[model samples]
Target chain A: MSELTLRPGRAFSMVERNLLIYRHTWPVLLAEIFEPMMYLLAFGVGIGVLVGNVPGLADTTVSFPRFVAPALLATAAMNGAMNETTFNMYAKLATEKTYQAILTTPMSSRAVALGEVTWALLRGTIVSTTFLVAVSLIGLTGTWTALLVVPAALLIGATFASLGLVVVTLLRSWQDTQLIQLVMLPMFLFSTTFFPLSVYPKPVQWLVEALPLYHSIELVRACFLGTGWRHALIAIAYLVVLGLAALLVAVRRLDRTLRT
Target chain B: MTTAPLIEARDLTKTYVTSEPYTAVKGIDFEVRPGEAFGVLGANGAGKSSTMRMIACVSPVTSGTLRILGMDAARDGERIRARLGVVPQDDTLDTELTVRENLLIYGRYFGIPWKALRERCDQLLAFSRLEDKGSQAVSTLSGGMRRRLTIARALINQPEILLLDEPTTGLDPQARHLLWERLFQLKEDGVTLLLTTHYMDEAEQLCDRLVVMDAGKIVAEGSPADLIERHSTREVLELRFAAHERQLMIDKCAGVTERVEVLPDRLVLYTGDGESTLAAVHALGVRPAGAFVRRSTLEDVFLTLTGRSLVE
Candidate 1:
């Protein structure tokens, strides 16, 4: 078989293994769900009262909660996917030796990479859906196209999960994971998640636009706020190409690391 | 009623190409017959694990050919792995999952139907003598229990061949013997067993035929009895002497014994009759501190070949 070709059934077995592990570790799932809600309540609702309306997609000015809520949806997906693929994946590769054990079976390294990213997508979907419902209940959702956020959340999840796996392969120790936090915390704050990109200078805006989180927030906000189909498509194509490239790199790295 | 070999390697070698390329397994040839209990006996860093990984089809052969179950290892890895069971050197049990779940989930990896796998899980738990500890977390088990669970998990799919890398390396004597009994049962049930160990007694007891490997090459290959008989004498006399009397004793023993190994604290004399040799030493007025005679074992065979002890 080609190196990249994966048997879906075998890949799903890894998902099944994760499910079995998570069955007893539901508290971790609870924490994943709880973090996004706290972020939504603290930033969207609590701070929205003081911030008033902010600039949204397509030059529209919207309520603070409505503006922040869609960005939180995207952040929720990013967090879910990033947490699973980074810390959890590092443990599997280094400490737990989980993937090494799996590769002993008929499951190819590519299938394992695919399965883990797929599992991360499931987690991202769960978190994004919950956050979407919370914002909708609070009257933040303004368009029927907001439901498109679910699929967009999946794309965001795939993009981060794939890229996060690549970053994790570079990790030599647990301390190196703090570097991930260094990158993520800044991106979470400056990716136009809590504020408008217009607040930044021209050079800063260009730098923000180059980040994945900025595109993720733009795609999610456009879908949730019914901004424009053209804008969403651009973001979608960027994320799709980036996700596939990162996934290819991640699979090849996993093969090299695990097989040898 | 000899059957074809179940696993074969021709000029098998594995060179890890890192910043500094190092060859672990030099060119070596061996074959494991069906239903045979085969072993690769060697010390640490002797390339035993590297060879096992190659035959298990996890590590690709660097410059040679390896075939398992009549399928090429490089091309038919997945298919070959589907029919093979591997118990790695360390316990890779999912510490997060319970013992029973470990078996069930691993069975699922082989695409075994859930119902059938569940039944086999119970049978394997029983076979490993872990019937009561099925629900406990793997982290809670003792080293021997964990090793047994790893073996049971490998058998979840009822594979045709079982590959164990130092299965009882760290276990206590009792646990090691218990594991040996289970492996004996498997051998009787017609499963091909391929194992690697540095323990000479383990190889002697469990391996029907084994190859003594050192520095990535096979130095000796035969049944334990045959190897001992061929490379060693019928008996061995061990004499421990004081530091000052060592050379004097060696010079004294040079006349009676044909072969003698001088260790740091003792001198090992190889002879057809150890008791007569000891008597001869006494007649020479060499009152050694300690003296004993015993039958030659695989340890002697290894020492005869490598000039070093197996464990050291």
Candidate 2:
């Protein structure tokens, strides 16, 4: 039972390495922005024209784009974090053997895990912010509180990134990563991202609320709607606890895998 | 007063307990003094890498005491690792990065300051002979160039001890010689080196003293010259017979030398005097198809000690 040790400087070095890589490949950043933009355009704006109003808001009725905008922010964060931690992390660990090189230096495995999750959070925040701006340009923002969605998106990203790192430790091959798509797609479609959980049956609604992304969507939606601070705080606590627990598991797994 | 050894291991062991338990290192003992090149010479799966990993502080010793740079490896891994440089068997260069960026990022991992790390990166690029290719993506570099970059990256920390595991297992002859020359310069600069290799010539060329390992245990340990003198004869007489006459030639050549080894294509006769041994074989009315004589090498020492050839 070796205790995990962290040096913030070492962890920041990992982030800096990724930042250099991102700098060279800035075009890929546009691709991250594109995915959520497509979702917002096709579902939020296009479908909002047909669907008149949504009833889940606390005070007054809102159009479909305003209701769906915050959920897209949560989804953007989840996607960005998952892509970095799962595919990029696995590439470094198994395919490229980059972690082997990093381990030889003074950096600990725990530091590597923390640094990777932080990078994922950064990417998630960037994508979510881009989505927030796109929605504002489309005049979907209702309140000044919508700006708070950025932090909520970061919390969502941290939770998913930590969970993704845990999955990477258990992965045996590139093909196993397809299973992540299976888990994420269902959560993306059914976790109250595109619609309110009230649309589902009672038991199905309970399943939707039980998901990690559900809390993220609930928090971001509250921020955009300017209502439900108490419920939003509960969602924030849920994501914090989930992210911390996943982070602990990820650190332990990285230690076991790399330090062996 | 006597100074402490840079690396000290007493009965260090490593056992892997996956589905079925298997021991990789069977409690080997060795010490590397400061400013000396110490080598662990063995064939693949002989636990050389396992031992090197433990010393690198990346892998923990399963049992027994191990100290590196005067710190316990199990308890002070990070502290030990901070002062050490490691080149693993496989090249772990970041293919996505340029050759120079690889050195820079690796230096940053050791928390080297940015200004100093940039200077070190330039110096290391020159050291590895990749100064012109600093901006080239690592994937575009040849295997030898990639290996050199890895070694250069390891040195970015100005470590006291450098650990190399099979550093030249896959290089061409020219590449191997170039690497050996660079390593010699490192040795001259007073960096203590601990390396593992299955190449007998590499061990003979680089090591001041080495241990020959087989099946997870050291069979012999000494300087290359001393091991050859103690374990092997002065020279060897190689006699190749035609097909189907190999075993017959072994029987005929049995009493003419100290020992005879029957390889696939030839029979190696170990003796104090190779010419005399050849003369004795001819005097016995057995004319070999071809014959040659050479001085004993670390290969011969390994063969004499293990009763098996070093390369398999």
Model number with the top DockQ = 2
lDDT per residue as tens, model 2, A1-260: 01113356679888989998988997887898888788888998898888868765555588888888788788888888988999999999998999988888778888898899889988887888888888888888879999999988988989999999899999999999999999989999888877777789899988888899888888998998888788799999999998899999999998898877
Local distance difference test, candidate 2: 0.88
**What is the TM-score (0 to 1) of candidate 2?**
0.97
Give the TM-score comparing model 1 with the true structure, all chains together.
0.97
Calculate DockQ per candidate and list them.
0.53, 0.54
User: In candidate 1, what are the lDDT values of residues A97-195, reduced to their tens digit?
Assistant: 887788788888888888899999987887788878877887888789999999999999999999998998889999999999999999999999888
Specify the poorest-scoring 10-residue window by lDDT in model 1 chain A: A1-10
Candidate 1: give the clashing pairs: none
Which TM-score values does chain B get in all models?
A: 0.98, 0.98
Which tens-of-lDDT digit does each residue in B136-187 have in candidate 1?
9898899989899988888876779999999999899999999999999999
